[model samples]
Target: MKIAFVINQTHKEKAGFTTTLLAYSALQRGHSVYYIGLADFVYLDHDKIAAHARIIRQIGNIADTQQLIDALKSTSKERVFMDDFDVLWLRFDPVLDMINRPWAAAMGLQFAQLAQKLGVRVLNDPRALVDAENKLYLENFPEEIRPRTIVTRSYDDVKQFFEEQHHEIILKPLKGSGGKNVFLVNKQESKNLKQIVEVICRDGYLIAQEYLPKAQYGDIRFFLLNGKPLIRNGKYASVHRVQSTGEIRSNIHQGAKAQKAVISPEMLQMVEKVAEKLIQDGMYFVGLDIIDDKIMEINVFSPGALLQASELNGEDYAAAIIEDLEKSNGKNKTE
Candidate 1:
């Protein structure tokens, strides 16, 4: 099967990224792989979607991640139609390009939605992604599984939420990621609360969430493929990300350390409820940010960290994922 991963940028993608891991894993299984940057897509007449993508041909002994990275780095890109591939995996981070490339992520999804119309399997359903344009989508889920939250652009509204939450809240951009522009504010002592809200709201809405005390210990990054916990040999495809001391964000890029995760019954229950709806909505691969029993975020577009999860569990989780994709050809293909 031919699979193409839509990424933020070709040069920005590192060897350790989950996109690289999944792409490499697909290649190792002798499947044709392609990497298309967000800006590389082309829409043709007659309702066709195409792109200039870097194709990963099975080069000599491409056995590991590093070798695969080297192979990708050395290869050049070529024009390819989405109809030629079995899967158009949306692995690009929408928030990463929200500033400079504000139009990039949206355009990529627009093309993916077009591709889906052409019978291409667009993972995590591009149409559903349009509804999940930002963090507010979590509000659509079961209220019990999410933290008390409010979205606002006004400073007074944010201040009200802060005070209502007993003077403690986590503030961030509704559309932001990678732990960027996230701030934990205590109303009594926070001098920059106004400025934080101003900065976050400059781009879009500001999300004020009740700061979970468990956040100090970090959150778990749980991977769900096809609306279920991705597991191999009884080990879940998940990782516990412990934040650096004094940090509130548990994102790995923000210096959080990854460790083996414990899948609690509460977590499973929450996942089951969320997955049932997600599967119906076409969210094929997802990552849930779990802090205590509340879900901090639902990562549908470019949900990652499967590599860390695989390593922490000592399991070949990627292999299982690629194999599943192979065996379920028309299962996930969008009409």
Candidate 2:
């Protein structure tokens, strides 16, 4: 089967990340792959989607890592239609370069939907993704599984929220990732809260919620594939991400350490309730941020954790993810 990954940019990726591993695994399975970037996709007449893709033939017997990457990058670019592939994985992290081209941020979801309409299987179905666009989507979870929250741009709205909570609050842009512009507001920083709100809210909505006191330890990030735990050798694809000592954000991109984690019952419950909906909505792969068992965020587009989770569990999680993709796509195409 031919598999193509629609990404933001190839040069932006680093070694030991989930996206790279998945693409490599696909090649190891003898499947052809095309790595397409944001500008690669072309919308033709009648909504046909296409891109110039680098067709990676196979992973040679080279043991050295860097050379293997060189071989992967050496493929010639070819214009491949989205309908030609059995699966089109939207592995690009839009938030990474969203500020650069705001319009291109939605291209993955938009084209994924188009490709699906043409009978190609896409991860995290585009329809579900459109609904999961912002942090406010977290509120759709069971109330018991989410932290007390308020979404508003009104100054009075934020003040009343802080007054009611009367504790440290975690404020961030409603539509954001990698913990960009996230803030921890307390009595000492109360005055700055308004400024923070002014900045983030100007671009979009703001999220001001009761900070989970337990976040100091770290947050547990769990990966749910096809609405089930992708556990192998008794290890689930998950990890505890500890923030940089005094920092409130635990996103690994912001200097967080990944460690083994215990999947609490609350975490499992939340994943189960949300995963089915995600899969039903065409989300094959996803990640959920759990702090004190409250669902903080649900990453539908390019939900990455395979690398860190695989590192902690002593198994390559990308292999598991790609295997699942093959199985699901095979089943769908056969049916």
Best by TM-score: 1
**Which lDDT values do the candidates have, in the order given?**
0.86, 0.77
Q: Candidates' TM-scores?
A: 0.95, 0.92
Candidate 2, 44-77: lDDT as tens digits: 8555678888777666673433554566576667
Q: Which regions in candidate 2 have their CA more than 4 angstroms from the true location?
A: 61-69, 72-74, 331-335
lDDT of 1 at 90: 92
Instruction: Put down candidate 1 lDDT per residue, 117-164, tens digits, no spaces.
Output: 889988979888988879999999999999999998899998888888
Q: Looking at candidate 2, what is the lDDT of residue 17?
A: 63
Error of 1 at 17 (Å): 0.6
lDDT of 2: 0.77
Clashing pairs in model 2, backbone N/Cα/C closer than 3 A: 124-283, 124-284, 125-282, 125-283
**lDDT (0-100) at residue 222 of candidate 1?**
93
Q: Specify the poorest-scoring 10-residue window by lDDT in model 1.
A: 326-335
